[model samples]
Every structure is written in structure tokens, then in C-alpha cells.
Target: MRLISRLNPAEGVGDFWAYIRRPQPYRWPILGLSMLMTGTLLFWVLQERYYLPPERPQVTYITTFAPGRTDEEIIASNIANEARKDALAAEQAERDEIRREIYRTFGRAAGMDVEKIEREAAAERAREEAAEKARREALIGESIAEPAE
Candidate 1:
């Protein structure tokens, strides 16, 4: 009641309804500020960086060769390199076998024929297409004559 009395009715009969009907001085500036803040907030949120975990850690190696290497050392190093090559080839073969076994296991679990699936399915697809073509031709075939005019 004290607050209501303090409001000036003398200021152009500025009652509650009139005050509400009147244009707000700060409306557009407040709206613009609010929109700018929201836009900046959304921009910051959408453009934020996200780091993903790597599948494997990066590996780096630094190698140096001696200038005064002997013949015996060179021959031993060559033999070691040859042994490393054979080990690498064996590792690759074992990895391939393991991959095939994994695929076979999964295929069996899924009730799928892993080995014969690709080749036999291709053959079956070709047969099915030929059968469908023959069926369509038989329905609208040269062998079947048109009705008499």
C-alpha cells in the first residue's frame, strides 16, 4: 500500500494498466543483449573441441651408425637382419591364420558358412537372376501367341 501510494498518478495517470501498456525504455536493448549472449553461448558450445582416445600409441625410434665399423661386425649385422626378416615373415603368417580363425569362429557363432559363403552365394545370386528373367519372359513370351482379333 505504501509502494502504491509512492507511485505518481500525477505522472499522466500512470496506474498499473497504463504502466503496463506503456513502452519499456530498456526492452529492445535488453532483448538484443540477451540474444547476443545466447548466440555467443551456443557458438562456444557448438565449436568446443573434443579429444578422442587413440587406438594405438605412436612409436618413435632413433638409430645411429658408427663410422668405423669392422667387416666381422658388418657380417654379423647382415645375418641378424636376415634372421629378423624370417621372424617377421613367420609373424605375418601367424597373424593371418589367427585373423582367419577369429572370422571362422564368429561366422560359426552367427550360423554362417564362412569359406563357401562368398563363392556359393555369388553363384546362387546368378542362378536366381536367370530364373527370374526366364519367369518374366515366360509370362510375356514369344512362344505364347496373342488372342484372335
Candidate 2:
């Protein structure tokens, strides 16, 4: 279009420079605000790149099955895997408990009410567990109900 062809970078640049040169009472404040906005925008845009950790690669668990495997062998393998997972989970929980006890000991020595904090944490965990149980029960009830004809 003729309108688009008439637009020139030289004219825009000159106008911008003219505006910047023109003295106004609020010019400094406006410039400060603009700089602040630019800095904030740059920070917001680059935060994940600089502040946060890099993304982790996806984990893949490979299970190789032979050409012909017996049902008992498969079942035993599954049971063993489940038992191993459970043991690892239990070990992790124990380690966490031990760490918490150490922290509580240090906190008490520092005159902090670790016992009160522990009690509050325990109550919150109980509430979360109860909620999870309710949700599980609701899902189970839905699955058990017969479909209407």
C-alpha cells in the first residue's frame, strides 16, 4: 500500500531523538520508570535461564523379557521388584526421620520450640493422608457401581 511505502526509519529515528532532546518537568521520572520497566522485563525474561536449575533428562526403566517366560517367573520378578521398591521407600523414610530428629535436637539446643513445630507438621501430614484416603475411597466406590442400562 502507498501508506506502508511512505513510512521511513529515518523519520522515526529523528522523531525519537527530537522527543528525547525536548526538556520536560517529568522527563527524568519517565526515563527512570522506563529503565526500571526494561530491567524488570529483562529479569523476568531471563530468570529461568540464570536463576533456576537446568532441566533433567527423562528416566527410562527398561525391563527385558525373554522369548518364552513362565507365569511363575514373571510373577516372582514383579513381586521381587515391588518388595525392593517398598524397602527403598522404607529406608528413605527412616533416613528422613533421623535427619528430622537431628534438626530437632539442634533446634531445642538453640531454644527453639521444635516439639511444637513437629506436632503441627504431624497434624498436617495426618490431614493430608486422610484426604488422600477419602479420594481413593471415592474412586473405588465409583469403579464398583454398576453402569445404568
The per-candidate count of clashes, in order, stands at 0, 0
lDDT of 2 by residue, 99-138 (tens): 9989999999999999899899899999999999789878
Displacement of the residue 70 alpha carbon in candidate 2, Å: 0.6
Q: What's each prediction's TM-score? A: 0.33, 0.46
Question: Measured by TM-score, how close is model 1 to the native structure?
Answer: 0.33
Residue 38, candidate 2: C-alpha displacement in angstroms: 52
In Å, residue 140's CA in model 1 sits off its true spot by: 55
Kindly report which residue pairs in candidate 1 clash with one another. none
Top candidate (lDDT): 2
Q: What is the alpha-carbon lDDT for the whole of candidate 1?
A: 0.83
